[model samples]
Target: MVLSVHEKVKSERLYKAFDLMAAKDLDAAETELHAGLSDAEAQEDKVLAALFYSSLGVLYKIKKEFPKAWKFYEKAEKLLPEDPALKLISARLLIDVFGQFDTAIRRCQKVLEISRSDPPFLHQANVTMGLALLKKGERTKAVSCLVDAMQDDFEGLLSASNIDLKLVEALLRKRSGLEECRAYLEKALRFAESKQEERHVELFRRLIEAFPTEEATDVKIQM
Candidate 1:
């Protein structure tokens, strides 16, 4: 496809934003990303615009502005109807930004239906689907999704939020399999504690404190 003047401008601005991110100047990155979004809209570059929105959502998430992140993610999802890449990225950002587990699940489900064993984004879709299901308390379903994601052999795809296959294992182990879960959570707790990610550490701690060991086994998912 031929690139329009506005699209070119937007693309350049987007590049600048990524450069800023690479330099660890998050604020500057956000400024450049916003500029790119503006140009993309002006040019009516729907695909590029959707991508920029998703990028904005990720930036906002790193900045801890969850609501703002969700706003941009929703925009991306709305704008990118024809592109599976755009849809999948938007969906993953929805989970990272808003913690809207159900919405993330739905998006992952849609991608599973459409993705034809492609590279890159297909792997991402699997990881996002797994995490979404996990967050929604669907232990069995979550394990299935994540296990499917693991088929891609991509590790860094979903590492930004300290969630990965290990986290999934810990969560499932704690709920479904007693000895296995305890061991997993203990390992996860060590990692979280060492990283000083107190919030995450507290989450695991709460599981230990709130429920009896026997009760942890055979726990039904709420959602």
Candidate 2:
């Protein structure tokens, strides 16, 4: 009975810490989560303990303390190896903060192997992999991965407005001087049905415009 009561208290504290973090009260969140971790340790709750470390990692990442972030993330991963979300997040943080692109790509690949049907995680994994690949000058592989992810159902992504595959393709095209993919820009524009879609489409339009205009508009038109 005492142990259960203690666990409940720790759980509540952990949630409160998470709320504080969401509210951007980093200091308060850290205090509360650390307190929860202390209680969880006393109760020998491995799962809750892992959650605490993962929560701290997120906080540290937000604070731009990458080393501290990964420290806790590693602990959490050791405790919960099956958590694809945590693994994905850790890989992203590593890529973003430490420029460990190769490691990030490898981690994301592992996520892809296990998360074939999980759209959201798969999207994250692919995005991270694409960005990492881009950093390594592997533009073709990057675009292939990113395009596959963008072609997936948007309902699984965080913001339907944010998946700008056309921009990535444009970037790759411009770097490689590949004018053949200009049709993809038009297709992306056609796909833009909503206001958010239109905004992203406009961005892609600008990118395509930046690409050197071959001949003139009259050449393509049959007036």
Candidate 3:
């Protein structure tokens, strides 16, 4: 279906706002989004309003304004509750920023149920769920989810965050499984080498050195 003139204007403004964000001009991006959001609100366009709200949420996240980000994200989700991306970001922000571990886990559970066929979404939901479970003091289950995420979709895990680094750090902090940690870094090292992510390769190398396996072979993943 063809977009009306107002819709086309809104779309153009959205693209322009992102262009500003890509250039790291976050203040300008915020201004652009605010303007677009006013138009969406004036028009009573829930879809466009949700889009603007979500974009504002991301902007605030980049600005490290977690409270404001969550506020906007909630607004977006209220308008489009079934959107998986909104739920995922809500889970992430809850876990990483808001310290609401149980809430994040519940959001991730919904994602897991709804996103079973979407591998990328599933990978991130699993990993994030594992993190939330870990924070909630379920060590055994957390490790199981983390390892499963890595084993099932290493590439997909990488697509979202610094997967290996986060996993290794969590294990190290917990002092849970040195063998598993070492193997994780080893796999990450290989991926970094392949991708030519030199800094990550070096970081993984250093982390692997700390583990120091005597066997000089691949450590078996227990999960």
Candidate 4:
């Protein structure tokens, strides 16, 4: 679809804002987001408005401003009802920031039901659901969801290795799945190596060290 002049400009600003956020320039990012929102509203583009609102929500979430994030997420949802990606992000915010485990689980499940072909979103949904379940003290179900998430490649998302490491750490805390955790750590280590993520590689190495001596020796041999 060919975007109108206004849409093209709005899109550019949104991308700029994302870049600024990644650079840790929150003030500049917020400025660009508000500017994009203005352009979107002037163009009467609900989709663009929803995108800016969602971006704002993400920005505030990263800043640890839960109330502001929630407000923007609500605005985005109101603009674009049943948007799977936005819903997944909102669910994550609810779980991580707001401590709304049950609501996050339901929202994530809804996204999972609708987004069968989208592996990245599916991975996010399952990971969010797992975190929520863990928060709710449903460790068994949480492990199931985390395992399901790890089964997917989750290509194009940089956090895949971190998510895998998180699952391994969660399993380690449970202390009953050392073998399975080792497998996941191995996968995460490979992913980290592929991405040249030295920190994550070291993190996986440390986690592996926590395994039983024999198992750790075996894993080292396998590596």
TM-score of each model, in listed order: 0.44, 0.51, 0.56, 0.54
lDDT of 2 by residue, 7-103 (tens): 2233788768767866888999999988988887898877678768877887898899999989987887788777566466556545554566886
Q: Mind giving the per-residue lDDT tens digits that candidate 3 earns over 113-175?
A: 887766656666777787788788888877776676567435643322244245445655776
Model 4 per-residue lDDT at 84 = 70
Candidate topping lDDT: 4
Q: Candidate 3, overall lDDT?
A: 0.69
Candidate 2 has an lDDT of 0.63
- Candidate 4 — which residues are off by over 4 angstroms? 1-78, 152-164, 174-177, 192-203, 212-223
> Where's the lowest-lDDT run of ten residues in candidate 4?
1-10
- Local distance difference test scores for all models: 0.61, 0.63, 0.69, 0.70
Residue 94 shift from truth in candidate 2, angstroms: 1.2
lDDT of 4 by residue, 1-223 (tens): 1111122232789878867987899999999999999999999987778878977888898899999989997898799787676576556556654577887898888888887776666776787788788778887887788667767443545653335344445555555356555676677677778888887778778766656643333332222
Specify the poorest-scoring 10-residue window by lDDT in model 3.
1-10
Clashes of each: 2, 0, 0, 0
Candidate 3's C-alpha runs over 4 A off are: 1-78, 117-119, 156-164, 212-223
As for TM-score, the candidate ahead, 1 or 2, is 2
Lowest-sum lDDT 10-residue window in model 1: 1-10
Report the C-alpha lDDT of model 1 over 62-93, residue by residue, as the tens digit. Answer: 78899998998788878865566556555654
After superposition, candidate 1 runs with Cα above 4 Å error: 1-36, 42-45, 51-79, 151-223
Reference-based TM-score, model 1: 0.44
